[model samples]
Target: MDGSRTAALLGVVLLVTACGQPAREPGPTGCAGGVPSCAPSTAPPSTAPTTPAPSRPVTVLRGTVQAGVEAGCLVLATDRGRFLLLGGDPTVLREGAEVVVEGATRPGQATTCQEGTPFSVSAARAEPATTR
Candidate 1:
């Protein structure tokens, strides 16, 4: 074959061999196609979810029966702050006694303690001076 033809054939063989060869180590800058810059990461960035704080502070109320009225059988006291208990729960407790009430509270029947407006207890337990 002619010299020029032989050179052309050799060039084609080299190109084909290079394309068929296995990949080499990535270049210094990473896979930015010869550009000295790092390739974009496939992994996503991490983030944390936000949480809400508590609504209102707990109302831990406690106090003594300041007064008791038999009108509707109600007792008034200054619990955590100020409270008025409703009807004397025969199954629960009575007047002039220490009591521990819990749960959402509101005003009860009218009594001398607070005048018809008494603190209501969702639950009440009379604390006796002496255990019976």
Candidate 2:
């Protein structure tokens, strides 16, 4: 072949060879001497137990138990605010009862009671009646 034809054939051969080769992935940066440990991890995530988050602090509230707009729902009208009482002694949670309750406010909790913030009552006691 003439020199121009030979050069054109060589360039075509090189281009085909390069196209057939697999692509090389970039290595992880900041590795010391390309160590195996320095490569990006492919191992499954850890299954070991982790420390639990801290519990919310309990609150004390004094209020009068009132019937909610919805049936079977009890609410406490306190000085701070009204609380939708959940899971407490039925006797102490009766309507028109004056009570002191210990619990935590659960703002994100879902409930049918439309009024008051949600309060999960841990304990409750009725206030003794006093004569003036």
Candidate 3:
């Protein structure tokens, strides 16, 4: 064959050889292609925003019971703050007796009795004074 024809044939063979070769690197996608078991599925990233849950109210309290500002109810005095306890026997709670008052609390029961947040007492226990 003439020199031009031989060169053209050689160029075509090189192009075909390059086209038939497999890709050596997986790149950013991270998975191999065409060996179906080897390639990880390509899925679009999730766009949903994350959010925190709302906080809940307190349900338990331990403190000393004191007389309400008026009468007919009682107040719990802890180191944290005072709270008005309802729904349990107020007689068991003396002015200085330590007690465990269990209930939910909310702002503004709008009572003439106490100046603290109102708590509904589900159960009560008078913790005895330590002798020491």
Of models 1 and 2, which has the larger lDDT? 2
Steric clash count of candidate 2: 0
Model 2: per-residue lDDT, tens digit, 1-132? Answer: 999999999888866775675554544465443233355646678899999998889999998999999999999998999999999999779999999999899999999998899999999999855669
Candidate of highest lDDT: 2
Off by over 4 Å in 3: 1-58, 129-132
**Collision pairs in model 3:** none
Using all chains and alpha carbons, the TM-scores for the candidates as numbered come to 0.35, 0.62, 0.50
- List per-prediction Cα lDDT, in the order shown: 0.53, 0.86, 0.74
- Give the distance in Å from residue 102's predicted Cα in candidate 2 to where it truly belongs: 0.4
Instruction: Name the weakest run of 10 consecutive residues (lDDT summed) in model 1.
Output: 31-40
Q: Per lDDT, what order, best first?
A: 2, 3, 1
lDDT of 3 by residue, 1-132 (tens): 999999999888866775676755563466443333345446677789878886556577888888887776678898779988767875666688798877778675777775778887777888765788
Alpha-carbon runs more than 4 Å astray in model 1: 1-60, 66-70, 79-81, 107-117, 128-132
Best by TM-score: 2
Q: Which ten residues in a row have the lowest lDDT in candidate 2?
A: 28-37
lDDT of 1: 0.53
lDDT of 2 at 22: 58
Looking at candidate 3, the ten consecutive residues that score lowest on lDDT are 31-40
Q: Summarize candidate 1's per-residue lDDT along 12-107 as a digit string, tens digits.
A: 886676667565556443542322234445665657776887443323344455544445445445524555565445455455656666544444
